[model samples]
Target: MQDTLSNKALLKATVIAVFIAGLALVSFILPAEYNIDPTGIGAKLGLTALANPKAAVVSGAETKATIDVPKSVQAADIIEVIIPAGRGLEFKFAMEKFKKMEYQWQTDGAAIFFDLHGEPEGDTTGYYESYAIATLADMQGSFTTPFAGVHGWYWKNKSAQAVVITLTVSGEYSVIGLKK
Candidate 1:
């Protein structure tokens, strides 16, 4: 009799399994991966921070420019930063529509996941334009601002050790620096 379950018992077990899976998805998977915490249980458990920092940035408060650049084109300036292990941050610039800039950046032989994007000024909808997204050790190019706003790279270091990044740029832009 113990070798096989009755049809009713089998059906009940299946239903219970499905219910537990759904609960886990809502309480753990959704919040940890997508930053979706409709039930708030995940936040209570400190799972929301497991989500990619990009999600936080998207939902974060608007940031203002830090340093205003002069009107004339200046020599390329170098900026070096250290990304803490398993952490992420952003370095942005403010520019007017049609302004152009040349940039090059490389890490210390470690590949990093990055998103180069722009957010228009006065936007409250958490909308931004993504110019590039990739995992690479270096990037170099020029870009013309599509709108008067902030542009920057969101660099995520998935490595266990801190990674150093060196960036050089010459453009008509104001340095927004590290974003909070």
Candidate 2:
């Protein structure tokens, strides 16, 4: 009889321990980085003010324009690309596409971060959205047009210093929304 009681108690303890461990895994052990807000500050992630690329320039011999974005940025966010006409690198050198602009998507800010390295590896072309989702050191092709509008922004980095990109819009931009 004593042996039976002992066995039952052991089983119960084992079950309890297993349950607690499972809870911990879900709450703390899992990767909650992609999680986002359902509804808080901004309205539905919708169309925002268009970015005037002609209003600014990503210049300097080694001046790279870096833009950081929160991971919450969904596919509907507006990512305006503005390359204002200035005394920046001429179309020849400026036309080169950068092999590494280094970019990332964040949930805390749903921000897109990157830098505009010296000469580009190629040209960045077409319309893109915000959170146009890309990872660090993982990018392809180049941008041709001076101005572009995407759902989100992303880039690759090949430089040494981790550049922090800031979007200096000519107008107010919209906030990004993450999946609920």
Q: Which one wins on lDDT?
A: 1
TM-score of each: 0.61, 0.22
Superposed by TM-score, candidate 1 places the C-alpha of residue 79 at a distance from the truth, in angstroms, of 0.2
Q: Report the lDDT tens digits of candidate 1 across residue range 1-180.
A: 469989999999999999999999999999999889999998778677567321111211234322334333544557776778898888888888999989999998999999999999999999999999999999999999999988989999999988788887777887767787
Q: C-alpha displacement of 144 in model 1, angstroms?
A: 0.6
lDDT of each: 0.79, 0.30
| Model 1 CA lDDT for position 149 | 89
RMSD over all Cα atoms, model 2? 17.7
**Could you tell me the lDDT of residue 3 within candidate 2?**
39
lDDT of 2 by residue, 66-85 (tens): 22332322222222232222
Looking at model 1, residue 153 earns an lDDT score of: 90
Q: What is the lDDT of residue 176 in candidate 1?
A: 69
Model 1 lDDT-worst window of ten:
53-62
